[model samples]
Target: MWIVFDLCVEGADGCEGLAIDSTLDHPDAMWVYSQGNWTHSTFATGDPFVYVQLQEYGNVVEEIDSDSLVVRFGFVKNMPTVINSDLEISFGLPENDVVSLKIYDIQGRVIRQILKNKTLNAGYHSFSWSLFDASGEHVPSGIYFIELKALRSGQREVKKLLVVR
Candidate 1:
């Protein structure tokens, strides 16, 4: 699913407001508009920022002074439902490179290293976890974050997973 929000500020008249819009495609796709443009910020599993272009039509001579404008886009992935005890998260890269997948607790402590500096192929890949700590002990039911870092592209992706008894 895709969602977007737009906030417009008129420098000419000192007007400011917000506009919201969203769209969804059948099966598994979505599109959202922000600041009079479509955003692709949440396209697919590991896609980057969405491209957008803005155009304004007005006479420059009418303005008394310089004005400023700003735009922002954000999105999230709806992870599939999985048993907390059998929770396993995985993603693939576009090229063969070193990737790291780490699990961190709410206290910002490194609980386990699911994947560590492993060279992977360019395509879809995944990893599974049994929700256990480094010492082969089951952790308490709570929230956790899985961090994916790619060295080649210098990209970092984070996904949240839940564990319940």
Candidate 2:
């Protein structure tokens, strides 16, 4: 599990804090930031001020390609969202853990398994859903729920998703 120590300054318009690497065996040796739709690799020689592009849905769609970092923790900014054709879900992880994102009906029946026991890095992440079910069929418009679960950490967060299609 990831722990966050708040370090916010008044009138600054944003909060900042030091996030130690919790997932790596050697926290000082390696750091991993996961983001965007594509994957690339980069190695840094020293402390680099990473430029992260924040998408319309939320913060930082592109990751910092580096070996170590002082990251931000416990900042989850999932969109106050509704789904028509797609939905963008964003979350923050404290460490490297197996996570699952699932959609369920109002009656608590599983609709879709977006991420099933998938391992992910500790950082903010964004994922888009096409509003399709597990069998590749479009679901009817109704009230649904989105479940984000960290398997190893035993942390779960549920949000309401309204599909208007």
TM-score of each: 0.50, 0.54
> Judged by lDDT, which candidate is best?
2
Collision count for each candidate, in order: 0, 0
What digit string (tens of lDDT, one per residue) describes model 1 on residues 1-165?
A: 443334333452422222222233321333445443543333334332354433433334334432232211111234554345566464656566688888888788889998788877655565777889898999888778778887777778877667777
Error of 1 at 108 (Å): 0.9
Where does model 1 exceed 4 Å of error? 1-78
**Residue 26 lDDT, candidate 2, scale 0-100:** 35
Candidate 2: stretches off by over 4 Å: 1-75
Q: TM-score of the candidate numbered 1?
A: 0.50
Q: Encode model 2's per-residue lDDT on 1-165: one tens digit a residue.
A: 533223333343332323233223333443333332222334434443433322222434457765465444332675655768877788888788898999999999998998899999987788878888989999998999889998898888889878886
Q: Report lDDT per candidate.
A: 0.59, 0.67
User: Which pairs clash (backbone N, Cα, C closer than 3 Å) in model 2?
Assistant: none
